[model samples]
Target: MTTSATRQQITGARSIVVKIGSSALTELTTGLDVRRLDALADAIEARMRAGSDVIVVSSGAIGAGIAPLGLKARPKDLATKQAAASVGQLALAHAWNTSFARYDRTVGQVLLTAHDVSLRAHHANAQRTLDRLRSLGAVAIVNENDTVATNEIRFGDNDRLAALVAHLAGADALVLLSDVDGLYDGDPRKGDATLIPEVGGPEDLDGVIAGSGGALGTGGMASKLSAARLAADAGLPVLLAAAADASAALTDASVGTAFAPRPQRLSARKFWVRHAAEATGRLILDDGAIRAVAGARHSLLAAGIVATKGRFYNGDVVDLADQKGQTRARGVVGYDAGEVAQMIGKSTGDLPADFRRPVVHADDLVAL
Candidate 1:
């Protein structure tokens, strides 16, 4: 289906990614909930049997490890958290394997770090692996590589990771399962809350205040909304619903809130530059450059650069700032800081042969 497909079109999606939150899969006092796992497996298997490829992004490693490690609550320290993930990952994988085996279907486990999705080569490798697994008739179950990921490399929450995975796998739609049914105009806990049936873009969440999920989960409504936005920006439609409604959400159009995908599909490199990559330095630009890049969608030339701030190498992402220091865009620079310094105020034609082109090509740039 195309990016503009309606929620009714979800049932015909060729490929789908489902993300389940920790709160939906595990209990606070108990660990992994077997009934819930079985239900989710059934839902996924049904979709797969209907001729659509399904990928599951699940969270519950730390929650499952809590009881086995004799911890009274979720660990606060990073070391304990890593230890819990180490102990729980096996259990998590086994539960999924056992559940899927009831249908004689095999499941493959995939663990990823932030770098895996942000770096070009690593991203392509991950996409190839997932594509291969799907072709082999095995449903790929993905989770963050929490055991080895440092704080700097973590995706913060699996919501964002799931969004990136949806993009990488070229999923036609994304389903996020949580405790609540969908986004609300106000806190559902408080009286008189209403479910938001659809969100066209960020402006739909203008005055909405989103709080945290329960103790067992890391993401709240805000995280899920952000994830939905990311996936939608990449031209993937999204549906948010309660975990118990997985079967219906996959087959029915009106079960949950749906977010419409953007009309234009962003290239993989542009998506990464816009959402995942870390900027290395800043390039100060003049008013003419800002208007050209943001308004006219033009490439950034050396003539428009007033100054360069911080060190960066060729092919590294850098912030494109206006004279007032506000970052207007981000792009992959063609030259390092030193090379840029030599041609700062010169036109492309006036520069040496080595520097006779745009500093940051339009294709590599994303307007902020």
Candidate 2:
């Protein structure tokens, strides 16, 4: 996909996820910027009236709390950050609700943790909830469950979360509204920097000097690129534009960067296994097993088992490693770790009467 095609795709998108960064949503002197919030709400409401489904993934809880709590800057520790988020989430939702109320539009708040999307059942359920909310003519406002998420397991930024949400909800497009207009050849603050209007895939971002955003936000150009990759892989185009010009970006105007979607779409299970689920264990396979699993794209068998690591249950996603301990694939297992250990090194015919299923089905597997 080229820049022109990406722009065209953005223009045709009927469903979209618009992510607003903290800097774009907050005031330097006050907590929430009511004026900017109103502008964003108006643009979204107009789109809704036009019959487009829109979901907003907004980041500004901490920034919104800064003024009220008298904090000089964003908190450095997780506890303070969580406290700030708890306080600011209320303010943020209230502002959005109030703004949308003027247009007779209702808003619903949804806070999610990384684990929420990692589990297949939870992932599917979340998607259903979001879909129903949209069907009810309410804009679903989402944010990470920062108060409960630990540092090591956090989504880290709303950019990636928004992308994942777009994928989960089966959105047609993703609009990332930030302070910067779009990606550039170099940092836009530099004299020679030039805007790169479109990205087809990961290859296009090579050598591009994408920079970070304001202090209030965790994401930068790099995170947005990662978000675009995730969305594109899930068969959704992405628009990276300035929040100030959000209406133009959402419209047919080419006011920001756009990343075209891949032509192929992965199945819901494969998408969750590849992008959402966390690996719970590792299964080391022999040479023949590696060839069969990677080259032939077949399932793992007990005869090919070399070793196993970590405790895991049936239906859990696990890393399939080669003899060299390198991850070659990931898939949902058919048996628990203990059961797999008992069947290791045994041929299918020699397995116990109870252990008759394939260890990892091909349909459930995804190559790394």
Candidate 3:
């Protein structure tokens, strides 16, 4: 694990993604916080002027809608929440537009759903659109498509969406601006708690208590950590900081937790195949199959599969299970469930004349 001071030394990041939570966007008394919004826009414009590309993933549509709709608090039901989002999204964009107008910079709204990235074609298109927007010198503000997304279809929070956006935009770094300063070893409210500056890998924070943020924000420390993992896996460094300290964090002032990127970067296709896609079925494999698929990095073969679970079509994502029923990996299966069932336990050479391709190609598999 690296210390906070060490992480703060990372500078000169060319492209960055900054995510701000709803709590940081709204006023405590009523309506939106114009000062903070303006300050954030100014900071982003400064970065852009300094030759860095900046993308802002902002959350506040529901919070901003509360005052307009006369709602006392955030609505619990999904329908009401969506209604708030619909009303608030307009206000949110208007706020950014107004703020950025001071510097004569234009802002573009990009709403997305998890499914947008789940499919390969949609993901590629989204990436291209965002890249084009940045190249045109416009600030791209992204938010989840809350108006139409159900609980099952939602990205859950903006943290995950920001990480995904970072990957899509090929950002050099991700800055998650929230209410808290950074991740801590213990809850910050506790007297003995201390900030955690750098996370080398998953094992560093074994028993850290990641407490909930506040009522206005859906994500907590846990979600931010998960976001860090996602960005890190994609080889993008992540900086977790307070929304108030966005400028300092962007300047590498060591005001937040920094999750360093892994040395190896996964291909965009593999990243989408592994993390973005939802698995539709499971295939149980023997020990030999696990070693061949995971250890040797070979494609799954019908002979190694012992059992199949769930109904999945060809090209659907499926989990590879071991003999004990534990999932060892996930991949897109080349054959449908019915076809795989007929070919299971049969040697590659013994397969029926029409079934000869690899069960799950190496290009599709992602080790869990």
Candidate 4:
């Protein structure tokens, strides 16, 4: 476990990522809640006015569109969900725009799918865009592109998305505004739960009965906990509190469960390679290959590879696994699956001029 941040330090973090869960933003029957939006916008505006840059990851599009689309409750099918998102995203953006207008602040909408952050080029583009948006003094309101994202490609919840965004934008801290006040040792609904004030590492989460959010929401305390750990691992602290306490939480008034960050900061390339890229295939490596790639952190030569499994392209991310079936590293394969298969067990010098290089370059590889 790392040393937790003091209240004063937590309150002073300048770049922050604020995530608002669906349940916090939308009503079950009435749809979009203007009052909640206004209150949230006000808090965010206050933070910005105080010279802090804020990035918002909001989840409420599908939830907000359910009533207007004449659906009884949250949609079940993918098509229905997409339709609702298409309709609701506009309303979500509009509500934010209107709310921010009251405080004379600007908001930028950034919709992303898993693919946006998975591919190297797309990831860089998104990062650059976010940097530019913040440089211009605009708060970015981020959401998943649910209209095109299937379950396989979606982030699963905004909690995880916010963690990734925090890293992407180089945020100093993350605030997860949930329906609950903070993480509890047991189920708070059971009336005997106790709020855990600080989490320095995984050990702090021991014996906590974490659970998902309401049916209308995609994330719950469990997801928020996972997100907090993820951000903490990347050297970004996390504050989990109720949406109603946004002002207090942002001001670092000790209102939420704060997860302290690791002392060492992760490099951007390594962070993206490890967490963002989607592995499309697995490459089995011999002991020597493991020692070279995993132990020494070297590029994967074709001769060290014992075999390859699954279809992957030249630029697709692949997992390098030991014969024992444990993934030791992940990297963008320099050669396609077929190309690597043909070169398996062949020494670099024995291969043709064009086929003599490493299967995955060192720059593209990150030890897991």
Candidate 5:
């Protein structure tokens, strides 16, 4: 079947975010492989021509840099890894541009760090940039800003980044291309392992064990599964498939382990708070707070919180955890850490008027 027709038949997802894994786009000892790049580009172009707005979150800058820098393997140190990404990003971008030129389509490069999606301002900037690119008929090629992003602020792996990007781009669907063909009940290398063709929800992933990534990739089956679930939870259908089956998976959602999405899509603020925003600190809430905040869907109050951990300011993302340090929900704080410390454990009726407002408003919070 034609790629466009197949995709439309699968779902009415007019916009899609396709993540190409590092191992799928490059050779072990060489940089980005031209054949792999062209093949994937061809698939993406077909969808775009079919009138679907397509965005690609590609992870190959480090892999592509390895060959050009004469490195025998992936770099281990942060500095060396950054250097490799610096070189590889240029090559990767150029290759993407050249490959898409085959279909007479233009490519726009968008490099993002965790802060870009976490901070309200930067996140909006990214949204506008990609939206503008789409309006101009340009396919956005997004990646984490590996060159300058530090471990402290980076989006650990491209899989998570892709999921966050999928939501940020307002994509209707998310397709993650990995080294493996599909998610399995166990290690695929084992004789008894069976491919899980469909995932209805989180319960299906209980006790599932998947292997880690190869030498050239950062994501593994576990990460892919997490990303798929994250996207699916936000009402975005997700497909996890082998990179070799890029065209098939991109077109035929049934070709991979398809994740069914929630019928009701989350609002933009809820999606960002639950997935993209990074927690700057932790809020230790009592048992009553946990139930009230997460269960009753009540706004988190200072009286419910027992203590605060870490330094954070007003409007920053903070985890609302229990005494055992288990996070139950996430929300945007209304006061700084210093201010919150003063009001911890104080009842609204007992506190002054200025300090009685919800510590974290209900609208700004999301249950995990």
Candidate 6:
């Protein structure tokens, strides 16, 4: 695990992804806070002018919608929340569009649903669009397609999406701007807590207590940390800072909790499979299978699989876990769950001719 000294590498990254949570975006009870949004745009434009391709991942559709719908607080039920998002997404995007226009910068709104983000083909399409947007000198303003998404509107926030976007855009660094300044040793509301300047790995976060989301945002500090760690593991350094310090955080490395990236970066495809492709099923492997798949880095054999879980189709991502239920790797299953169930524990030579191949090819798998 490296220390904050690695911040030097992120000082002037040519490409970066900056994410602002709903809490920061909707500090005003009325709706989208224009002043804060404008400040953010100013900071982003400055970076773009300095020769960096900046992509913004924003989370405020639900929060911005609360005021417009006459709701006194965030909606509780899924339908009401989606309604708010339906009304709010427009307000949020329009605000973003107009905010960047002040500096004559074009902002392209890109909304992604969970399926659009996780599937292989859809993920590739999004990656291309973001890359092309950067090349055309436009900022990509990404947000969840909340109105149509089922699960995402609840537990999944834009922080995780930002982590995924960082790699999709091939960003050199990621900056997470939220209400809080940075990671703290304890609950930040308490006077005795101290801000943590850097996080090397899980060991450094042993006793940290990251609370849940606020009334306006779906993600809290816990989600931000999860997202930051996700990006760091994919070999992208991340800086978690306060939305008020947006300019300083982007221009320098001293304002926030800087997380060091892994020494080696996984190939873009592998990284996508590991993080973005949400697993649709699980295949339980025996001890020998775990050793071969995780330790030796070999293709998964149907003979090694002892059990299967979930209803997944062929070519869908699935977790390859051990009997102890620990997922050792994620891979694109070669067959449907029902089909895979029939071949479990059967050696290739002894199995039916049509089911003789590896259950998961090494080329389509990533060890966790």
For every model shown, the clashing-pair count is: 0, 0, 0, 1, 0, 0
In model 4, how large is the Cα lDDT of residue 287? 99
**What lDDT, from 0 to 1, does candidate 2 have?**
0.87
Superposed Cα RMSD, model 1? 2.3
> Candidate 1 or 6, higher TM-score?
1
Give Cα-based local distance difference scores for all models: 0.88, 0.87, 0.85, 0.88, 0.88, 0.88
Residues 249-362, candidate 1, lDDT per residue (tens digit)?
A: 876646778898898888888988988787889999999999988778799999999999999989999999999999999999999999999989889889999888789999
Candidate 2, residues 1-368, lDDT tens digits: the string is: 23387777767777888899998999756889999999999888877777789999999988888788888888889999999898999999999999999988889999999999997788888898899999999999999988898998889899999999998998888999988898887887767887878778778878987666568988988898888788888888888889999888877737878787889877778888888898999999999988988889998889999888999999999999987788988999999999999988889999877787789999999887
* Local error of candidate 3 at residue 54 (angstroms): 0.9
Candidate 4: where are CA atoms >4 Å away? 1-9, 352-356
Where does candidate 2 clash, by residue pair? none
Task: Please estimate how well model 4 matches the true structure, expressed as its whole-model Cα lDDT.
Answer: 0.88
TM-score of each: 0.96, 0.94, 0.95, 0.92, 0.95, 0.94
Error of 5 at 13 (Å): 0.8
Q: Name the top TM-score candidate.
A: 1
Q: Model 4 clash pairs?
A: 213-220
lDDT of 5 by residue, 330-361 (tens): 99999999999999999999888898899999
Candidate 6 local lDDT, residue 278: 81
TM-score of 2: 0.94
Across 1-368, the per-residue lDDT of candidate 3 in tens digits comes to: 33353354344678888899888898534868888888888778877887889999999988888788888788889999999899999999999999999888989999999989887788888899889989998999999989988899878999999998888888888889988888899887867998878788888788888865466668888888889889888888788889898777766546788887888878887777777887889999999999998888799999999999999999988999898888888888999999999999999889877798899999988887
lDDT of 5 at 330: 95
